[model samples]
Target chain A: MADITQLEAFVTQVRRDIVRQVHKVNSGHPGGSLGCAEFLVALYQHVLQRKEGFNMDGNQEDIFFLSNGHISPVFYSVLARSGYFPVEELNTFRLLNSRLQGHPTTHEGLPGIRIASGSLGQGISVAIGAAAAKKLNNDNHIVYALCGDGELQEGQNWEAIMYGSGNKVDNLIVAVDLNGQQIDGSTDTVLPLGDVKGKFEAFGWDVVTIEQGNDIQAILEGMESAKTKTGQGKPICVLLQTVMGNGVDFMMHTHAWHGKAPNDEQLASALAQNPETLGDY
Target chain B: MKTYIDTGKKDTRSGFGAGLTELGKTNENVVALCADLTGSLKMDAFKANHPERFFQVGIAEANMMGMAAGLTIGGKIPFTGTFANFSTGRVYDQIRQSIAYSGKNVKICASHAGVTLGEDGATHQILEDLGLMKMLPGMTVINTCDYNQTKAATIAIADYDGPVYLRFGRPKVANFTPENGSFTIGKAVELQEGTDVTIIATGHLVWEALEACKTLQEKGISAGVINIHTIKPLDAAAILKSVAITGCVVTAEEHNYLGGLGESVSRILAENHPVPQEFVATQDTFGESGTPDQLMEKYGLNAAAIVKAATKVVARK
Candidate 1:
């Protein structure tokens, strides 16, 4: 596993890339992307056992699925940094005919993405399916799914949660990016996701909460604990409490930055918080 | 009109059950998933035999669809069974992202499609499923008629890669197609050959089309009849050839005319060979509770309706 300093540097670089890439396009969901940066870095660096040059049928390595696909900026940055595709492709986000679609998809033969997931609430089910497949094939590889807390409002997510827990999808781990903010407003003001931990627990899943979703050490610790919970005859859910748009000072604590890219001045100020660890795309 | 010997009508879902059970014996990779509709979808046989492989999702169709998609990742061919309504509309996004967009090798088996679903009414009877499924990219939409063809389609989808939607029905219809006949995806099978008019039909209405052909033949109006089992990636060559000879077309299906087999056939004919066409189908309306025969009559999906449609099309020609 990488050291905390290295992981922090990697995460900072990823955040810069996400903000810069979104700023370049002037279109994308940055709030969740920024909020979940530390968790994303920890996942690629320490949690999942993945290899370079993407393989769709991953047998020996852990598989990951981004259920709430709006956070493609974070996902794209992590995948590129992890060597799934060229980092230069990050500049082509949402461009016409570009493999880096507005949402992550396998249609363009994007290296790391095995499924199109802009449509929320479907990823958990796909992850369950992949995990189930791993078991059937005796691969022993676990499937990890990351979904936004707001995305759980989608009926499909509930269906997936119920099915996974009821059927004993022991090889799956579902993580909720609980930023508590959505496009319209805060989750409480929009539609209160009353007791997400309790909700998942009631659904028969073994639920855990990461107190500091924006802290790399905390995120890593939470994920390691999640790994230990796998293959225990129950699907596990981690409720990650995070602030929307964590890195940028002005963007934090507001839903306005949920999908808005920072202007030139805002971008400059945001980039100032974190130095360029790796070169920007 | 010629009447085939009575071997007793059988529900197409039964064919699906038989085919899935047989497929399990042949392919160890074959697995089944149901959203609390095992009996309704006739997946009981597969569930009984392949207990480990069969998954009862318990009223969660979306999850059932997703798990099916995931099952395909490990080289396992997952067949998800449910009513047409829940299969297409209720879980459209799930299928769109996980299966269709991802290009997963999952088979979505939907039974009790169209008005023939009877007492369940419009909620269960999905007339728009054909249109909904055919519009998706890389989705092979198949609406099989009769017991043999449904069985054959179920067995065949396992060999074909990528996502496929197999639409069957609850009502029993003819079991006439040869048990040993090859099941091709986009090949249009000509049931009866005639030059005056071509009667194209799919699903439960193919039997009505054959009957309509017989009636037309007896009345000295040689009407051709073709069974278009596959709706998407339509057999354009066969359709154009039959249309060129007949010079007129009549399409029939147990679905709404808007995006049904009729519309697909008409679109093909209009583009390739301009011809006058009439459709025997529901006229963009929801179905009500009634017996299967009554619903077929009300929806203009009977043999007499096909005969009338053929006459009108020939008159226009």
Candidate 2:
């Protein structure tokens, strides 16, 4: 197990990176990035059993796919800090000729990204394929994917959800960032995703809910528990209940900041809350 | 004149199935996926032999496309089978973002293309698939002529390292190509040589163009015939060389005139050498339910149409 204090500091530093990267470009989806800070930090720091270097074909490693790729700020920061690439490369988050695209893509030869996923609802299906490949190779490592709750509105997600359980893709675990917020408005106002847990359960998934998604200990514990549910006949779904903007006080609990960057004063105030846990990029 | 004999008659989709079965036995990295059309797509032989690699996606084309793109991550060569309409138009965005833009090695093998998908009407018959696929960057578009060529192209695309769109049809046409021939990408095959006019054809129209050549011979018109299997990365050198010898050209295909082989040939001719050209294709109209023979005649995509276009273009020359 990893130290809880170190994990918490990693999450704080990730939050700072998310805000700073988006603020520098003055364009990006920061709300979901902030919300997914703890989950991503815990995933890279404590959860996944990774190999030494980055290669396109992850033969036996625990591979991850970011289906909702708009939140690349958090994904890039976590990957760099976890030693996938140089930490200072975070300065080229969405710049010209940078490997870091606005969405996560493998086109630029990025080390961590295995697929291009900005169009939404594609990650789960891709994860299922990778999981199937793992089963074919007899590789016991698990395949993980993260998606947004609002992205479920795409009909493709339901098709993948139906396929995951029907085909018995047991080596896969899908986690939904159930922030209840989208670009339009609250999920309820825009399109109510009524009973998301029930929906997954009805689709024959072994479902679990992480009630405190923003907490480092809760996410780590929940992910550890979810890992044990694999190798069974059914796939697993972790409905992580997170705030749209989790760490910062002003950006939380709303959909307005879903794709907006903070201004000068707002950036200073947001950075003050998290402090500088591990030197800024 | 160089004469060719028809070995047999077989549906192009069966050739795809035969090639897939060969791949299943040879390449362990090759995997196949279908959208609940295993029997229609003739993938039963492969599925029966290797059930572990065969995935039945069950009527969800979008999911199948995404999964195929995903399978490429672990260095698996994925081949997705379905009708041309669902393979290209329905799940285009999935193919564009996940497969084409990402530069994954995926072979989108499509069957039941053009008006020859008889009785299914315009919805099932996709005439615009070539244009849609060729427009995307880094996409290799191939429309094979016959059964033997289709099988060879299917097996050949596996070794090529990029996304490919292999289009074929349902009806059993002429199988004249060699049984064990080498299928090279972006190379045109010259069937016969003449000096009056050039007759370039693709897909079902290649056989029709050959028949037109015979009739034009009787009328004292020596016509050149070329088989263009690969539409994109077109053999412009072969086209320009043939047209330079033969002053005029007649392009034929079982597709719309706006974005089929005819338009591609015209573009090459206009840039390099402007020549009088006539199109033997459907004139911007949707096809209705009819027999394959009747639809081919009604759409003016037969040997008679090709012969007429060749004679008219030669007259202008």
Candidate 3:
């Protein structure tokens, strides 16, 4: 386990990266990005067993996919900070000709992205395919993916959820960032996702709930437990309960900042709450 | 004129099955995924022979497409199979985002294309598939002429590393191409030579084009036939060379003239060397239940239509 103080510092740095990257463009999903910062930070910095460099062929190593690709801010930040690319490149978050597209894609030859996402309900099936490939290649590594709770409304996710369990794809884990907020409104208002835990359990997944999805320690512990449940004849689902716009005081508890960037005044205030432990990009 | 004979008849879907069966023994990285139309798609042999490498996605084509895209990350060449409609229209966005945009090396093998799917009618027949597949930037779109050509093309796409849409039909068309012939991605086949008019065709219409050439020959009009298997990276050089000699052209296929091979050919001619071109295809109409022969005749997608188009186009020239 990573020291709580050091991990907490890394989480603070990731939050800073998310806000500044989105604030520079004035167009991005800071809510989910901020919400997913701790889970991604814990996964990349501590949990995943990946190789030194990135390659499309993920043989002999674990791989990750982001189903909710609108949260590219956090993903790109964690990837760059984790040594996939230079931290300075985070400045070109959604600029023209930058490797960072509005959604995560490999078309621009981005180093860490394996599949093009932002089209919801796709990443889980991609993860299952990678997991099946790993089994075929005799590689003993796991495949992980993250999806938003609102994304579950797409019928294709239900199709994939059924396949993952029916095929006995045991070397896989899919986590839902249950922030309960989407573009229109909260998930309940937009389209109620009732009994997600029950839905996944009925689909035959081994379920675990991280009640404190924004807390670094809780996320780390929940994910680690989820990992142990793998390779035992079923796919795992982690219901990570997070706040929409987690770190910023003004941004939290509302769905307004889901895809809206912060203004100059709001940026300074958001940064003040999470002081930069590491220098800014 | 070059004379041709039908050795026998075979459905193009069986050709795909045969080619997949061959890949099973040769390439270890090759994997197959079917969306519960295993019998209709003729994928029984590949599934029987290589059970471990085959994935039965069970009537879920969207999931099959996503899984195929993901399987490519671990160096697996995944071939996804289903009807033409389900393969192209129903799961288009999934293919666009996950496979086409990402540039995954997958083979979207589609069967039962066009009116020749016969008794199933419009819901199963997909006339706009070629247009949909070709519009994507990096996608290679292929519509095979016969069983032998479809088989050869299926085996060839595996060695080539990119996304490909190999479209074929259900009817037992002429088994005329060489059984062991080599298939090239963007090259066109010149079936016969002529100077009055050129007849270009794809899928089940190549045989009709050949027959049209014979009918035009009797009327003292020499008709040339170019079998265009790959429609996206079209054999533009061959089309240009043929049109320069023939001076007029007729494009035919088992698809809608609006977005099918005819439009693609028209674009080529209109840009470089515009000619008096004719389209021997369905005039923006859906197909209905009938036998393959009756449907082809009713839809005006056979030799008689091709000959009429050729004669008229030649007169305009």
Candidate 4:
């Protein structure tokens, strides 16, 4: 295992990247990005077995799709730091004529993204397709997907849930960023995702819930458990219960921060909580 | 006029089944998914023969579309089988983002298209499916006339690496085309050659156009019949050649006169070759619950309608 200190430093720098990118663009969903920074760091640094460079086709390597692509801040930050693209390009986050848009997409011929996924609840389906493709090609590589808990309210997600488990898509590992909050309010207030775990279980998926999705160790264990559960003739779903804004003090536990960016002072204060480790973009 | 004979009446869905099974035997990457409509979609053969590749996605068409788009990521050629309404309109967004926009190699095999879907009424009968699918960028839209053509299109779409919407009907109709005819996209098949007027048809209307061609010939009206199987990436060369000779056109389809094959042809003619054109299709009205024949006749999609359209176009010419 790598040093916890180094991992923490990486996660911290990822958050800094997210803040700097979103703050510079003055647009982007920062809440979930910040909240899921540690989880993303843990997955990229430890959980997933991806290649050093990002390839769109993902021929022989494991693939990951950000279904809730609005949380692109965290995704782009993680991807850039993990060596998908240049760290400097994160500055173009929502800029006109730049590959980096407000949401993650393959439209701009983005090096890492294989499919466009700004439309919520569609990523899991794409991930399942990728996993199925892996099985067909005899690639044996796992496919990972991350989606927001609130986005699960889309009927499309349930369709994916049913398709994945029904087809025995066990090569896929799907994690729901159950921050409990969305753009409007708490998930219960917007739409009660009643018994999400039970729902997935009933749909024939192997369900795993991470109580501390924001913590590196907890996220790592959750993912490890998910990996062990693969190839069991059932798809896997991990309910990651994390704070809406994970690391930043002012942004945490608030729905307002779900898609909102922090001001300069707020950005400075947030960056103070998470020290630069991997060097900020 | 071109002389055409019907071998027999067979549901186009059966042709899809036969083609899918044939694909299974030849290609390992060919996978099929049905939204709990395996029997209706005639996918039983594929499911039974290639159970490993066949996926039953339950009643969720949207999810099924998304999954099909996803399956293409790993280099699997996925064919999603469902009614036209569910395949295009119901899951357009899923198809838009994952399939068309992402440029995944997927075959959206839609059965029970147009008013010919019959008895299901307007809810299940999607007259706008052709338009909906054709409007998407990088989408190849095709409507096969008979079982032979449906089978050919199904097998052919598997080879074409892009998003394709292959539309066919549920009812049994004419099953005569070359059993092993080479299917080429954007190439119109001249069923009959004449100069008085050009009768262009797609889907079930191809049979009607053939029948109309015979009737028009008996009436001393030399009508040229062209089967435009591929609606998008339209065969401009064939259409212009036929229209150039006839100087008038009659477009036939079991779809809405608006945004149907007629409109597509009109748009092409308007831009490239100006010609007097008539449409044999459903006016802007919803289909009612009726037998397939009754619905086709009521919606002005029968051979008699095509004959009338040919007469009018010939007169104009």
Candidate 5:
């Protein structure tokens, strides 16, 4: 088990990396990236039983697929901090010829990323596939995927959701970042994802919810419980109720910061809130 | 002139089934996923033999494509089977992002391709699949001519790394290729040798090109036939060699003249050896409900069409 204080410090550092990377590029998705910092931190640092180092074929290790790849800022941060790559590489996020693309991809030979996902609603299906592969190999490792709530509107997600549970893809856990905000506006105004929990349940998934998704302890607990629900003949769905731009005060609770980079002054303010816990990249 | 024999008539999908069944027995890592077309795609044997390795994705081609891409992360070679239309157009973005862009080893096995899919009409018969797949960077686009070649290609793609689009058809065509032939990717097979004109074709059109070659030989045209199974990473060398000797070429395929095998050959020739060329392909039109032969004849994708194009191109030369 990871120490609570150490995990909290890691979450704070990830938040700093998210803001810094997006601010450095002056382009990227910071809202969702900032929102899921703690969850991703918990996942990599503690939750997932991953193998040492990185290989393209994650044969016996726990694999994660980021369906909402716009959140590459936080994902790259967590992956780097987890020793998948050098922490300094986070500085190259979305830069020309950088391994850290605008969206997470295995194309550039990025260590942690398994699939390319930016065009939404593809990750859950891919996770189901990896889980199925694990079952075939008798590896018995769980596959995890994170998706956006707004991304659920893509019809492919429903198809994948139905297939996952219908086919008893029980060795997978899909987490939906239910921040309730998209690029345009709140999900309610854009396209209401009515009762996301009910929707997953209707699709035959075992649904769980983390009321405080940004809280490191809560995320760790929820993920631990979600892990226990695995291998029960139904895929798991975790509705992570996070605030958009979670750690930063002004950026939180709004869709304005969804894909926009924070200005110079705003970056300083965002950095102030996060603090230099593990040193800036 | 070289001669060939027709072993029998069989649908290329059956060949896919046979290959997949063979893979199930031989390779434990080879997994199959079908979008509710197990019987149509002829994946039933594999499904029955290795129930655990087969995934019935139930009418969701996009999700199936995503899953196939994901499966590759764990070193599992995934073969996604579906109709040509649903396989390419319906899930093109899924394949582009998840499989091709990510450089995953996924075999996208598409059956019931071209107008010869027959009664299904234009909605199901995808004439642009070859073009759609070939345009993607690093995607290996293959259109097998007969049952034997289709089966051999299916098994061959498992060993070959990276993304592949293997197109076959539903109707019983002339199964002339060797039963256990060595299927090489990006290498054109020369069926006949001549100097008057080169007849290059793919998929069902390969048989038509061969038949046209026989007709041309009767007329003292002495045409050469080359079966170009792989369209992308095209055998430019083989095409150049054939066109260098023949001085003119006629490209045939069950696809549109634009962006199909015809255009690919034209580009190769224009860059290296500019030759008088004629296309024996659909002229940018969708097909309607009809028998396989009727559709082939109406679309000018038959041997007679190839002969007409060959004669015209030879005259131009």
Candidate 6:
């Protein structure tokens, strides 16, 4: 295993990248990006059993899908920092003619992306399909997908959720970013997602809850347990209860910053809180 | 006029089934998915033959479309099957984002298209699927005329990499094309030579156009027939060549004239060789419950309709 301190440093760097990239464009979803920095960092830097280099057909290796692609800042930061592409390309996030689309897509031939998401709730179905393909190809690698809790309201998610467990899609893990917040207001005030874990369990999934979702150690440990639950004739669900904006003090525990980027002074303040762990893009 | 023989009659969906069954035996990477319409889509053969490769996503077309796109990532070709309505309109966003925009190599095989679906009425019939599919960038839209052509097109698409929409119907119609004939996407088939009028048709109307050609000959008019199997990336060269000789054209289809094959041909003629054209399609309307023949007749999508349209447009020239 690598050093935890170094991984934490990478997470801080990813946070800096997220806010800085959004601040430059003056438009993006920074709250969810900051909130999921550790999860994505832990996923790319440590967890995923990735093959060397990138190809659209990710054969013989673990593949990932980002369902909540509005938080693309963190996904792009982690992917670039992990050597999927040049780190300097993060500067082009959300810019026209750039591969880093506002949401993730494979149309521009972006490496490490198998499907286009951002319409929400579709990543689960796509991941389930990939998992079945791996089974067909006799590849023992697992498939992982992440979606926002608020995205669960899309109806198509339930269609896919029912499909995954009913067909015994056991070689997959779907995580929910349970920030309890959406664009308008908190999930409870907007539309309550009652008994999220219970709903998954009733739908024939193996549920794994991570209460300390922002901590690198907690995410790693929770994901490790989720991995162990795979290949057991049931699809796995990871409920990650993270603060909306975890790292920056002012951005936390509110729904206001979900899609709003930081202003000039707010960017400086957000960057100061995270500190410069590695070099900035 | 050159007479063509109907070897037999068969539903186009069976042709899809035959092609899929052959692909299941030939290509290991080919996989099939149906949203609770395995029997209706004539996919039972492939499902039974390749149970491991076939996915039965019950009653969820949107999920099936997304899954089909995902299946392509691991070098698998997924063919999603359902009615034309469910395939195109019900799950358009799923198809647009996951398959079309993402550029996945998935074949969307839609059966029971247009008024030929009959008795099921307007809710199940989708006369605008061709328009919807062709609008997407890089999507290959194909509407097969008969059983043999549909079978060939179905097998041919497995070899062509990219997104494709293959449309066919449920009723048993005239199987006129050669058995085991060569199928080429975007290539038009000119059925006869004429000097008076050209009858360009797609889907179930090609056979009707041939019938109209015989009738027009009896009326002392020479009408040529051209089969447009592939609508998008339309065979503009063939249409122009035929229109140049005939000087007037009648476009026929089991779809609305607004954005169907008629409009595509209109754009071509309006730009290249300007000619008088008449549309033998639904005039921006919906269909209702009836026999396949009754609906085709009521919607003016049959041989009589083609004859009148051909006679009228030929007069303009």
Q: How many pairs in model 5 have backbone atoms within 3 A of each other, for residues 3 or more apart or on separate chains, i.e. clashes?
A: 0
Give candidate 1's error at residue A70 in angstroms.
0.6
The CA-based lDDT of model 2 is what?
0.92
lDDT of 4 by residue, A1-281 (tens): 75667788888888888888888867788899988888888888887778767665687887888889888888888888787789889888899988888887777876778888888888887888778778877888799999999999898888888778767899999999888888789989988988989999999999999998877888888888999999999999999998877788888888988777778898889888978777766
lDDT tens string, model 1, A209-239? 8999999888888888988998888999998
Model 3 chain B lDDT-worst window of ten: B1-10
- State the C-alpha lDDT per candidate: 0.89, 0.92, 0.93, 0.87, 0.91, 0.93
lDDT of 4: 0.87
Could you give candidate 5's per-residue lDDT for residues B1-317 as a string of tens digits?
A: 77678888999999999999999999998999998889999988899888988998888888999889888877899999999999999998999999999999999999999999999799998989988999999999999999999999998999999999999999999999998999999988999888999999999999888888888889989898999999987999998898889999999999989889999998999899999999998999898999999999988999999899888988997
Give the clashing pairs for model 3. none
Once fitted onto the true fold, the runs of candidate 3 whose alpha carbons sit more than 4 angstroms away are: none
**Mind sharing the TM-score for model 6?**
0.99
**Candidate 3 per-residue C-alpha lDDT over B1-317 given as tens digits, one digit per residue, 9 for 90 to 100:** 77787999999999998999999999999999999999989999989999999999998999999999999989999999999999999999999999999999999999999999999889998888998999998999999999999999999999988999999989898999999799999999999989899999999999999998998899999988999999988999999999999899999999899888999999999999999999998898889999999999999999999999998998898
Candidate 4 Cα misplacement greater than 4 A, ranges: A55-60, A272-275, B314-317
Model 6: per-residue lDDT, tens digit, B1-317? 68799988999999999999999999999999999999999999999999999999999988999899999989999999999999999999999988999999999999999999999999998989999999999999999999999999999999999999999999999999999999999999999888899999999999999999999999999988999999988999999998888899999999989889999999999999889999999989988999999999899999999999998998898
> Which ten residues in a row are the worst by lDDT in model 6 chain B?
B1-10
Instruction: Write model 3 residue lDDT over A4-57, tens digit each, in one string.
Output: 788789889989999998999999899999999899988888889999999898
> How high is each candidate's TM-score?
0.98, 0.98, 0.99, 0.95, 0.99, 0.99
Greater-DockQ candidate between 4 and 5:
5
Q: Could you list the chain B TM-scores for each candidate?
A: 0.98, 0.99, 0.99, 0.98, 0.99, 0.99
Model with the higher DockQ, candidate 2 or 3: 3
lDDT of 1 by residue, B70-155 (tens): 88876789999999999999988888888998899999999999999999788888899999999899999999988888999999
Candidate 6 positional error at A106, Å: 0.8
Minimum summed lDDT over a 10-residue window in model 1 chain B is located at: B1-10
Model 5 lDDT, full chain set: 0.91
**Considering summed lDDT, which 10 consecutive residues are worst modelled in model 4 chain A?**
A50-59
Tell me what fraction of the real C-alpha contacts between chains A and B each candidate also makes: 0.85, 0.63, 0.86, 0.72, 0.84, 0.77
